[model samples]
Target: MNIIKFSAQFPVEKSCIEHFKAQRDACGVVCPKWGCVHPYWLQNKLCYECKQCHHRQSLRSGTVLENSKLPFMYWYAAMHLLTSTKKSYSAAELQRQLGHKRYQPIWEMVCKLRDVMGKRYNLYQLTDEVELDNAFIATLIAEEEKDKPLKRGIGSQRQPKAVVVNESSFVENPKPGKKPKRVNHLKMLVIEDLRADTISKTVNEHVNPKAELTTNDATPYSKLFEQVKSHHAQAIKKEDLPKTLPWVNIAIGNVKRLLLDVHHQLTNEYLQYYLNEFCYKFNRRYFGDA
Candidate 1:
């Protein structure tokens, strides 16, 4: 929903809390101690009481909001802004929008949301035709690497490596000046290295075993054939990348632009969180205002 609709729906903190409670009820509240699905709502305490074991849990228990002291309105507003836009907001921008005096809490809240988004996407694996590629994004050096001499080029301390995977299929009866391949889901995973073992393990975990894979003949993807049903590795010329692996390259370029545009100085530690937010929004691009 847009800002107006969201404001109308949740005008006050109590409204947000009530809506959150309703959503949690729809998802079902399980007792943490006994693993019981049925729990009695303790209206006075704003918690759930186990029907059998008498265990009690707060509304935010077991959720990303657990241990967070921020108001429910803050989280609801953050989620709305994050999901409702094509790009993202930095923690400072979000803090200003919320009119909050603190920055770290808002930053942590956004990071936790992004973390859960990555975890949610992990539940599904890319299937059918898939494209794979590696991306090098500019990231701040780690604290421990401060003393080490920085290398130049792609291996520089400022650049971090990530694996980009896109689920795509051939588009039949394509329109003029349109992409030959259509994309479905996308994933960008931060990794330590681009070794063959690392690439193979990542593909094995995130992609279906029977999926058809396509990528440039990079040594890191040498063992991809063992992970998927078919690995069509080729030496892709610079211009041929669009035809060989269209969606993966496009995804990489778009994400790079996103980071460059909004988040200027990203750190290696939280690069994955930023990537998670990008992929989450891209995957749900069709779901308008949902």
Candidate 2:
């Protein structure tokens, strides 16, 4: 939605007390100990008290907007801006758009909201026809460069690896020297190790066992299919060009662009967070006017 529409739908200083009250009461029971239930007092401007423990839990508690000193209208406006845009915005840009004089607070606020959005992402389940792959993420370090010998064996290598596992979905493939058409579907992961154990653990945690799996003919992924109902393998030649699934390629391409264009430099320590943010946005790419 545009700013005008968003403003109309959620006017500035519109009291959220009733909204919070409704959300609180939706639980149907007041059990403060479990952190879900509360009693709404209309006379107190919809202030709620925990029924079980009688503890006071504000409406923003357990929500993304919690602990924010910013006004509710600003928070709502920020959410609208972040969710409505396909292109990710830097904190500086957000600060400018919000017309906030202080950059640090707005930057921190955007990061926090991004964190909430990351946590709220609905990731794919490894149910059927999933793709598994890995990509390298290099960090720019300010040090003299030295030639490091390439290791021959995967088992002996020490380079950090990003293991991506995603579902198979159709995406539009654009032709060269023209606006790219979007097709194909896939998900991804950035991992520290490509070892069988590490990859297997991540898959087990994120993917459902009932789903079919696919990957390149890698030694580490050989036994992964055993744990699931079906596992398939495809081989790619080193000399051959990468024939990626359309949506997967687009997603990865966008991630590469973000790394180069937005962040510029990312370390292994925080690479996963960056990946999560990218994937969250990518998965929601089709949620128009959200």
Candidate 3:
């Protein structure tokens, strides 16, 4: 929602808190101590107190807002702004919008949101046909050296590896002038190393066992077959890249442009969070207007 709509929906802190409580209730807040899935919500204290063990848990307990001293409205507003656009707000920009005196808290909050986004995406696996590819994203150091005084070539900075997985389907019967391929869902993983073990582990974690994997890496592809049902070794040439890996390529390019616009310089340390926000928005693109 836009700021106007957000203000209309959440007029006050209490409204935001109530909405958060409702969402927590929908998720079935459990007694963390007793393992009871059903817990009685104490309206007076705004906490879930256990009947069996008398364990009292606050509304923010075990959620993204846990231990956060900021007001619920801040979080609500942050979430609104973050989800309101495909191009995300940097912590600096978010701090400016929040009108907070300190920047540390706002920065931490943005990082927390990004961290959770990545973790939430881990709950589901890609199914059916999937096209897998690796792309080397230019890191902050790499981008920084582009304007170096010494024009005798730039120094080498490690480019981060991104594993891009997309749900792919080819049109069996197509109408005239229509594209023959379509890409649905997508997932991206930023890994430290590009070893076969790392690639296999990430692929196994993200892609379903029954899905077909297509990639250029013959060694890793063969290894992934044992993890998944089938593997197709399709080496995508430079000309066929856009056609073969449509969604991931577009997503990567979009993410790079977004980071460039928002942060100016992208770092390997926090690139995953940026990826998380992009993937999160991309996954929910059908939600219409802000």
User: In TM-score terms, which candidate is top?
Assistant: 1
- For model 1, residues 232-261, the per-residue Cα lDDT tens digits are 999999999888899899999999999988
Worst 10 residues of 3 by lDDT: 149-158
Mind sharing the TM-score for model 1? 0.96
Q: Tell me, what's the RMSD of every candidate?
A: 1.3, 5.3, 4.1
List the candidate 3 regions with Cα displacement exceeding 4 Å.
Answer: 35-45, 51-54, 141-157, 173-179, 217-222
Pick out the ten consecutive residues of candidate 1 with the lowest summed lDDT. 258-267
Candidate that would win on lDDT = 1
lDDT of 2 by residue, 107-216 (tens): 66776776665465534465555666777655553233224444544322333467666666433664665323233234456565677887787778777798777667
Better of 1 and 2 by lDDT: 1
User: CA lDDT of each candidate?
Assistant: 0.93, 0.62, 0.81
Question: Residue 105 of candidate 1: its Cα lDDT?
Answer: 96
Per-residue lDDT over 105-198 for candidate 3, one digit per residue giving the tens place of the 0 to 100 score: 9989988999998888878999888888776776665556557653222223546778889887888886886556677777888876667898
Model 2 alpha-carbon miss at residue 24, Å = 4.7
Q: Give the TM-score comparing model 2 with the true structure, all chains together.
A: 0.74
